[model samples]
Target chain A: DAGITQSPRHKVTETGTPVTLRCHQTENHRYMYWYRQDPGHGLRLIHYSYGVKDTDKGEVSDGYSVSRSKTEDFLLTLESATSSQTSVYFCAISESNQGREQYFGPGTRLTVT
Target chain B: AQTVTQSQPEMSVQEAETVTLSCTYDTSESDYYLFWYKQPPSRQMILVIRQEAYKQQNATENRFSVNFQKAAKSFSLKISDSQLGDAAMYFCAYRSARNQGGKLIFGQGTELSVKP
Candidate 1:
């Protein structure tokens, strides 16, 4: 309900192929995040952006890169998809006044074969 | 490094009954925030409740409440008169007070099943 949207709800790709996931928010929030969910690991942060062209690596940023060229759009790119990268990815946005209650998009289920 | 821990991998509660989910976090910052998010079968993360560390009073929404013990470094969620719709995966999350980017550290989740 936070006006967040993620493109390509589902994707399947072969190993060594490149994949990109996009997140767009209509609320124009300044904070955007990318997270991946896997069994035994609830959700791990992959990357986040605070402003246009301002990004930072998260705990599991290895093999993943993100870019925020505009306030409402953030993109996550996997240079070479690997089987280990198969998981459900979520995009979230938050307003500074909300104090960390992030509004999440539905999610993207990616499978790498 | 701040970390959130949810020990219960799965839980079950009867309709109209009460249930409590345990969550513990380790953080060096005195001022921070804790949150409980519910992810249904649809896998969409929804915010259920939130607690601020600086506040001594526990936070409560309609049927959901939290037992925030700062001394014990514990933040547990309690659902009273649980309903069937409560069935979902519950996650505990932590965020620093000094940060404004809304970066969260999540715990391993607890899958809750509500029975009739």
Candidate 2:
């Protein structure tokens, strides 16, 4: 278990509402990633941060945004929720020397009505 | 661009038996990494094994082992003496060796059921 946790394990929000999910890690890892899991799609990267205040878009970055102000915290926000955004979101982290072997958090299930 | 594909959507194996899951990836780069991640009912992604493309020998972790065929671009996972705990969704992922933020391309997934 990597010391990673995602707040609001589950949530239901209406369409067009703003929602933000938080990922907190204690390992002080330099790499943090956000992914969404859906049926038939194992998991798709949403966004990732390499260090404090440095971020990049992933394969599926539309409708989502991320910010990393500190090493331990990463935030993913949905500016306006939509039905297509309903899915399980996961947070993962890896050390600088570990290459791409990432450890994942428990995950957050968000529903858009 | 890199892509990973898991042809089997579902598979089942009897307890104590051996089962192999198939994975194939497409990449122009010769240097990269392949990984198998297990997601149980708890929904936690656990790293089962990994193989570096440059290595000729296969990689193994306890009961989990990988058959890496670089020329064929195939990576398969073999589970020996399978147990109930092995029942879960298995995912195969590919990452380039280049320092491109270590992004990973994942397969759809294969749901593995272990019969006890």
Candidate 3:
């Protein structure tokens, strides 16, 4: 509803394969974030970008990487997917300030066998 | 590090009745922000209400309001005239006020069921 779209909404892949999830926003928000949601763990931030080519790691950044080439596109890549990495990924966008409400994308459900 | 806690894993309320969901947070900073987000079965996160730490008055949005106790570090959401559509998983979140692009820390979430 926030003009945010996540491609490959659902994907099932075998272990040790490379996977990439795409998040595109029409709002051109300055801040973008990638998060994973699991049972019992509501949501864990993986990586975030402040601007084009400016990124930072979050609490759960291990084994995952993110790149922001433009203001509206942020990509999350899994170098070698593992069973443990299977989870629902969400992309969020916000303005350039703190405490602002974040708008979330529908989400991508990735399953690794 | 800031942390949010939602003690109730599940809650229920009758339609047109009132319900309250509890949330507590731990943070060293005196200034921050608290938020409540609702995620329906659709899995889309929606902002239900928000409270600024510096403001003493609780935030009220339509039938939704918050009981923010800054000293106690407790922020609870009260929904009045609950509707069947209110059934969803509610998450409490916290963000730092000092930093730009501050990432949010969320609670485990409380699933609210609206009974008919």
Candidate 4:
């Protein structure tokens, strides 16, 4: 409902391979975030971008990288996939300066074997 | 550092009945925000309600309301006249009003079921 869409809704990749998930939003929100959801550990932020070429690490930023060149697109890349990286990745956007109500994308499920 | 905790792993309620989900957070900052998000089987995250720590009065939206006790650091969600659509995993999250860039810290989550 927030005009957010995630590409490659489901993906399976072998260990040590490179994978990248894309999040595209039409709302032109100023802040975009990437998160991973796993059992027993709610959604953990992977990385986030406040504006073009500006990014910051989150609670769980290891083994992942992100880049944003435009306001509508945010990309999360797993340099080398691992079994531990297998989980559902979500993308969120917020218009405010502080973390407030964030609209989420459909989510991408990536599997590393 | 801020943390959110949802003690209940699972809960069930009969349709048309009222059920409350518990959530507690630890934060040194006095001004912040608390939110309740519902993720149904479809996995779509829906915002149920939100409460600003600065506001003394609780926030409500239709059937969903929150009990915010800032002093106790407690935030709970109450669903009245629960329906089958309410069956989902509920998450409590905290966001600092300071310079966190709106980054949210989420709880473990509670799976709620509504039985007919």
In Å, residue B44's CA in model 4 sits off its true spot by 0.8
Per-prediction TM-score to the true structure, in the order listed = 0.98, 0.98, 0.98, 0.99
Instruction: Please report, as a residue range, the 10-residue window in candidate 3 chain B with the lowest summed lDDT.
Output: B95-104
lDDT of 2 by residue, B1-116 (tens): 88899999999999999999999999999899999999999999999998989899999999999999999999999999999999999999998888778877899999999999
Winner of 2 and 3 under lDDT? 2
What are the per-candidate TM-scores when only chain A is compared?
A: 0.97, 0.97, 0.98, 0.97
Q: Could you tell me the lDDT of residue A51 within candidate 3? A: 95
Candidate 3 C-alpha lDDT tens digits along A6-63:
9999999999999999999999899999999998888889999999999999989999
Greater DockQ among 1 and 2 belongs to: 1
Which residue segments of model 1 deviate by more than 4 Å?
none
Model 3 accuracy (lDDT, Cα): 0.94
Interface DockQ per candidate = 0.67, 0.62, 0.72, 0.70
Could you give the DockQ of candidate 2? 0.62
Ranking 2 against 3 by DockQ, winner: 3
> Could you tell me which 10 consecutive residues in candidate 4 chain A have the lowest summed lDDT?
A92-101
User: What's model 1's TM-score?
Assistant: 0.98
lDDT of 2 by residue, A30-62 (tens): 999999999998899999899999999999999
User: How many pairs of residues collide in each model?
Assistant: 0, 0, 0, 2
Interface RMSD of each: 1.9, 1.7, 1.3, 1.2
lDDT of 1 by residue, B11-101 (tens): 9999999999999999888989999999989888999999999899999999999999998999999999999889999999998888646
**Residue-level lDDT tens digits of model 3 in B43-108:** 999999989999999999999999999999999999999999999999999988886467889999
Model 4 misplacement above 4 A: none
Position A76, candidate 2: lDDT: 100
